[model samples]
Target: MDHAPALVVCLTTVSDEKQAEALARTLLQERVAACVQVDAPIRSFYCWDGKDCVDRELRLVIKTTRERATALQQTILRCHPYDQPQVVILDCSGADPGYAHWVGENTTED
Candidate 1:
């Protein structure tokens, strides 16, 4: 049996590739995230100020340790342009041993 520390999987959508790249670069530069995958030109629909809104956005998937989740979220919130940024964190129970090791090695010291 193998027990490894949990990984935090966060998802947020941005307005464009520039925004997505900026966020990813900042997170990686600060070592807040091991890696960030960006999916651009996504269609999103949600409620805002009691009104429904639809827009094209880019989605960012950030990978980090559970210990860094709070800090990562705080950074995103502070840097995000939206009044209410869509930041969601999910827990990764298990991952490939090699990949997990790589993630741990790349991330900041926890």
Candidate 2:
């Protein structure tokens, strides 16, 4: 097991399950994400354009490394259906050592 100090998790919302799966597959295929957890039928309430809005969406939890973050963001933007997609990154202080190692090694360059 290889230990790394930090990992990166990307959270993004998709219009539907299919879109979520597609994005996940693309990221995995491109080795931009080691894994992606998809949660669908999520109820989202937020303010947009100074108005409160609610919608159903699917969320993708992408597991990767800090090195892959910028590229991952770009790919998500390219494939996302929304004009302005929500792609947020979380810094992880610890995780499964082997899994983290895999994530660090898998991603590609910009």
| lDDT values, one for every candidate | 0.86, 0.86
Query: What's the true lDDT of residue 41 in model 1?
Result: 79
Per-residue lDDT over 52-106 for candidate 1, one digit per residue giving the tens place of the 0 to 100 score: 9999999999998887898899889988888889999998976776776667777
lDDT of 1 at 103: 71
lDDT of 2 by residue, 9-101 (tens): 999998887888889999998788889999857999999999999999988999888888888898999988898999999988758787777
Pairs of residues at least 3 apart in sequence or in different chains that clash in candidate 1: none
How much does each candidate deviate from the true structure in C-alpha RMSD? Answer: 2.0, 2.0
lDDT of 1: 0.86
lDDT score, candidate 2: 0.86
The segments of candidate 1 whose C-alpha lies over 4 angstroms from its true place after superposition are 1-3
Itemize residue pairs with steric clashes in candidate 2.
Answer: none
lDDT of model 1, residue 57: 93
TM-score on alpha carbons, each prediction: 0.91, 0.88
Instruction: Name the candidate that leads on TM-score.
Output: 1
User: Model 2 reaches what TM-score against the true structure?
Assistant: 0.88
